[model samples]
Target: MKYWNLKKINQSAFEKTGIVPRSMSKLFNRFKQELNPNAEVEALEEFKVAKYQTSTSIKYIIVLLITPILINQLSKISVLDPLVNHLWNKNSNYIFLNPSQEERAFADLQRFEEKLHFEILIGKLDALSAENVNNKMSNKALAIALEYSQESVNAIKNIIADFISIIIFVSIIITNKRQFSILKSFINELIYGLSDTAKAFLIILFTDIFVGFHSPHGWEIVIEAILRHFGLPESRDFIFIFISTFPVILDTIFKYWIFRYLNKISPSAVATYHNMNE
Candidate 1:
């Protein structure tokens, strides 16, 4: 006996009848399932699905939590570290994380010189010759440079470790299609199973946190931190432009999803969202 693909069968059936919306198709399936003759068999199938989804969720959590630390430890083994250092650290700049760090170092030196001059004017210390002032500034600048260079090296190590972790994550996702599908279904059910009020509350919370009036400040800080983590230049123009465009795009996509999918699947939740929003 040939196994039937119910999904494809449904698609073909719908096409024969006429183009039917997905929401209507889903409702029909739900009604059919409710009226199934083998109710015990349906319950057993649901139990199996729940079991698979739960196991997949646990595996995902373990992999996400442990993979990064395992990869980081593996990267630090004596065998690999020397080769990585030779290949990566050879050309990596040891002076600063980025040009911005150098600029900040100079700015700090300038501020120190200004403070020293102010102290002299106030007679807080004996007057120093220009040669002595130059020597002090040079020493301070060297100290700052050394400190920043060490920070740069540490940042590079972290970046390499994170890159490896990302590769492992992608590999797992690629290899585990069945688990991925189960997890996807689990997440969909988890979200759609919530009460209408719960859905509205979550939607409001997400929107307020991500794209609300107060979100630009949060985005600016996050962008600055990410740039610093990657030793990239924290350009004000780039940050401002991203903040202006990305949130608007995200908000648009979010609204479209609500209108296109959520509105069809759960009209009551959408209505509740609007009422609560008003």
Candidate 2:
């Protein structure tokens, strides 16, 4: 009677939580004696261990190959150049030899439309705000996007120039270990990435800043030379100089600043603590 009562209590407890009692194995054996018997379970422990081992080995090999290339690539950013030397196959694809990329009056405009939708976005953002605060954000973001596009353009064009500069800088470092040590960290920080509008803005802004003015469509080089040689300043009393220089400088500056600005705006942590201080 006591055994039967204990069995009933155990059954009631198991029913409540759906956990089998220790003695349930005996019940299964009894059933198996009367019925058929075949139990099967496949285990995957060995295969899983082998797969994890192979993955770790492959990751180590990849790191060994990539680390040096990444380190070398990080080392050059500034110093001005004559601009003509930065070429891909002496042109950007078909641009240099056949014709020119920026030769068309509205090349940047049309290209931006196709890939970036930049102008349309700016228009929408501007329409969203009545408050001065909201309006400022719209205008600022619009300007930055425009600038980013331009900077990205200049960065690509100047790729050769940057490469040449890197080679020279690296050579200098290799020859003098002491000098190299002074700038190791700086070299690592020198690689620049610019978005399209930002690139355009920097190219425009710098030309304006350096020579002091802006020209999007682009005056002929001969025409610009004639003006600068004859004494034309951007702000006062000079006709051609202001027209020639301002546009390029402003365009360059806008492009670079906007590119950097937008990069910081995204979720990724920026490189320097100075960005935080600002």
Candidate 3:
């Protein structure tokens, strides 16, 4: 608080000192580069796959999405959910499995590296979460640091949502040709962006109005209504999720089909990534 209140930026003094931290300045320059649609890393990282999923391929696109939403719904989940809080704690005070948390995270990520699609998503989320924690866990008070209005926290949340949307949209493109894995970190990402007000509101709304901790799970009631309307049994939660996936799946297909066709028709004008990594 003292530093935040006291540290004033003077335009002339800044010009004289030119004292931007190398690490902070790099991000600004990187963001400027990202304004280019053809930024080198973005192009390299995005690969177009012809065969996305198949009968023989893997099932499950990360069951972990539900976990964060639930963990996030809990009051003061900061103190309640250790793995998640530990995973999400915006500080570096904690260690994992005898190694630095980030190192442990990378090692944990190695298990899925063989699946190229899984590898990429894991890399993105783990790095995102760990970085979010590592940067703010020290010095700042947890309450203020976690405030939704706080820039650093908001940045991580926005990035997580953006990442999930990208993963979903991209997964749609590779439909039925291959199988990919999604990890827990994807959901953990959104927790960063919520404002203290937003989180408090959500905690109240989801608990009291929507889910009602004393009553049946909100998902159950919604599922029951839809299932009964369709003359299906209410017991089959999997059926509901399977059905829900169709829209997102098809939208992805249509989007990527458009992109692929465009690239095929006008490779020079539209294509930037080589479509295969070196």
Candidate 4:
């Protein structure tokens, strides 16, 4: 029995449908063009025949909504913030000596800290606010408050990005009825890729949490030790930035590998999905 053959499954699809894939840029443009005001209604009509397809589209929508929530929660873990703050303090002697640069860097850091707090607040509000409450506050007052709030701006950007992703996902499904299996397989790969990425993230998070619980500032000490062993600069700022960003970078690379592996195993699935637009 063949245990795993995404390649064979994809090949069968191609042999059955004879579709050719389009270039990535062209496919992106096509999706952009498909997002007309009437696109939602049209997409619903297109998938009406395949009830499963419609259900899959809804699932994608739910994923889109949930993604930001997950990201917000992860950010609240503040894994990087302490590191960054510690580094800033360590470099303060040198940083303080250069008054001009110090002033600017400090200002920027303050702004960043404020932005982070705002994001945390927005995340809390989004997670908590299921029902729209009627406030007796005037529209002008609310507008003024939002205008001054950086988090409000960030919230809008997140919402816009989420909306666009949902549209693209729905459009892909609606436009490629003939290649539903290919599309479905492609989406499954994406879901799997993200799952793997999340798993890696959780491992790191739990490890950090465990270390933190056992020893205060354990991550910093460990990172500093590693840097010292390597004869590298063990400045708090450098280590902070490195530890804070490295996980995200590593997660991205892992996700890319997952995608590439999926494509390697099922080239025809990707090709069919890509060419379905053509």
* Local accuracy by lDDT, each model: 0.76, 0.40, 0.38, 0.47
On TM-score, the leading prediction is 1
Listed in order, each prediction's TM-score against the native is 0.75, 0.18, 0.18, 0.21
> Candidate 2: TM-score?
0.18
Better lDDT candidate (1, 4): 1
Point out the worst 10-residue segment of candidate 3 by lDDT. Answer: 47-56
Q: Give the per-residue lDDT digits (tens) of candidate 2, residues 1-278.
A: 43443343334223321233223444686577556433221113323433433453355434434543444344323323233335323543333211222332145444544433453366653433337545555565455444543443444534544465456555644675432332332222222234334434444444544444223324445444433332222222344555556656666765465445433332122323224324
C-alpha RMSD (angstroms) for model 2: 28.2
Per TM-score, what order, best first?
1, 4, 3, 2
lDDT of 4 by residue, 1-278 (tens): 12123343344335321132223333676687587788776556534433444465566656545755555444433433354345544654322222333344456555654654576588853422323222312333344333323232333344444455556656655765545654455455444334333534543455445433343355578886554333344466776776676655655765564355435544444444335424
Alpha-carbon runs more than 4 Å astray in model 2: 1-52, 61-69, 78-98, 104-278
lDDT of 4 at 248: 55
Identify the superior model by lDDT, candidate 1 or candidate 3: 1
The residue-by-residue lDDT of candidate 3 on 42-108, one tens digit each, is 4443221101111112233432244334433342234334443445566644332222223434544
